[model samples]
Target: MGTLTSILVLSFLIFFHELGHFLAARFFGVHVEVFSIGFGKKVFSKVVGNTQYCLSLIPLGGYVQMKGQDDMDPTKVSYDQDSYNTKAPWKRIIILFAGPFANFLLAFLLFIAVGSMGVNKYAPIIGKISENSPAFEAGIQENDRIVMINGVLIEAWEDVSTHIQESVGKLELKIERAGSVQTLIITPKINEYQNMFGEIKQKKMIGIAPSGKMIEVSYSADKVIGFAYDQTIKATTLILTSLQKLVEGVVSPKELGGIISIVQVTSEASEAGIVALFALTALISVNLGVLNLLPIPALDGGHIMFNAYELITKKAPSERVLTSMTTAGWLLLLSLMALSIFNDIYRLTNGN
Candidate 1:
């Protein structure tokens, strides 16, 4: 049941994302050749108004195929007129941006609904602290009420996790022990361990687990809006931080995951509470949306970049240049996919 639910949720998200592109293309009078719900071999398909909509065997990701999307012909201007390439640059940009925008809106709506229903927030009480860990070194004791991390006000234990995971190295913690406010300076330590996925370089040893005392507060309109806005901003910041770590070589390439990881995570999350599952889905959806907006070839960002260039220069790039870039982009994408899959397999075989 859990697995099925996860699969369904994932399918819904991907379908909506692709639908955004499809609808935008249709609105702009662009001829969309295909609308696929997944990649690889097609399992089922149907034609509707100059479009072949398909449900592929794999329930991974989906795509929309716009006519003349990748420099199909040089002499065919009429076909180009009805194609994605012939659209005005602003129209193309809007169509390109719609997918991610839809995901963002979805997440915002989810957050709003959850918040309006009065979500639970865990009480700020320490359950345990590792011996000689950062918490211990900083004079943090069990049963302390964690008030803040790095000067940010925290209402729940998740805020602590979010702040710690996002902030590297030393962190300033505020807590209330024995009705007295106390400040502690804690330094995070890196721990390398293999999981069923890869060698996860996670921050550890400052281990103070939060006590399980959940509280539900009445949800107000302000709270809903504020929480949703914060969620989007914080998630974006976290992604930027991870990217910086990746560039600095602190994060390994093997830590990168593909669709398999998403499925596994979604399945696990589905077994958790509704809020937990919703949060997971929203996180992944937002991540996918942001990732696609990156200026990498073979992606929406790449197409948007070309459009931007064309607008600025008042001329489209040559077919040769676009072809070469697309080819190189595919190769890079394939190589990354291979490495991630290899890492996943290796970790699984080693019982990591």
Candidate 2:
């Protein structure tokens, strides 16, 4: 039941993503040749008008196949009036960008729903401190409010987390207690924490926790949209920052996980409840949207990059160049996928 539910949820997200491309292409009068919910041989299929709708054996992800869109000529070989290649650069750019935009939109909607119910907001006040931990040894106490970390003003509990993750051995913290502010220096303990998804992460821990507060947030029309947008931006920013850290080796690739990890997360979230499930889905959707926006080949961003070049130079890359670059992109993506899978297997087997 859990496995099926996971697959279904994944399919829904993929469908949501593909729907964007299909709608955008149709809006621009481009013919869609195929809309498939998976890869490999089709288990079931039906043709409607000019489009072939298919459910393939693999349920990992789905895609939109438009007329005149292929590996050789990304715009596809088409002289037809409604061919994708015949579209203006701007239109093509929109079609390429819409898929990720759809995912982002889905995340924003999910966040709005979550916010309407209420959100658990954590105060900067310390609630608990581990014995002999950095915060404890530094004379930090429960009820002390964190004001700053390493000289940066701390506005929320998340700011504390953000600073801690970037810190090395020692950290300087500013705390307010009994109407007096004090600065203390302490070194964090290197520890491993297992996340809700059962992924183990190695982080620098100060052993302080926030005072949890439940805020009944019934937002106004404008506030709801603002909150959703802010949350979406925050999630995207986190992903991008992590990517930067990964490149700098501040984060290890061993922390990475692929489809198997996502399946486990989805199954666990579904078992937990609707809020957990949707929250997980929303986070994943944001990741998908942001990751696709990276200027990597074989992705929507790469297509947009080409369109930009075309608009400037008035000529698309030769078919051979497009095929070669796209093939390289596929190879790079596959390699990364393999690495993520390997990390997942290692972490699971080693009890990480």
Give each model a TM-score. 0.75, 0.77
Summarize candidate 1's per-residue lDDT along 8-112 as a digit string, tens digits: 888888888888888898899999899988778999999998899999988767888888774233223444677887789989988999998878777777777
Model 2's TM-score against the true structure: 0.77
Residue 326 lDDT (model 2)? 85
Question: How does each model score on lDDT?
Answer: 0.79, 0.85
Query: RMSD of candidate 1 to the true fold?
Result: 5.8
TM-score of 1: 0.75
Residue 351 error, candidate 2, Å: 2.1
Model 2 lDDT tens row, 1-352 = 7788889988988898899999999999999999999989999999999899999999998888888877434535887999888899899999989999999999999989877766656767888889988788889998999899898987668778989989876889999999999999988888999864345888889898887843344557778788889889989888888888788877788888998898988999899777778778889999998888877778888888888889889998887778788888888888999999998898789887
Tell me how far the alpha carbon of residue 144 in candidate 1 is from the true structure, in angstroms, after superposition: 5.6
Q: CA shift at 69, candidate 1, in angstroms?
A: 1.5
Q: Look at candidate 2 and tell me the lDDT of residue 82.
A: 90
**Alpha carbon deviation, residue 301, candidate 2 (Å):** 1.1
Clashing pairs in 1: none
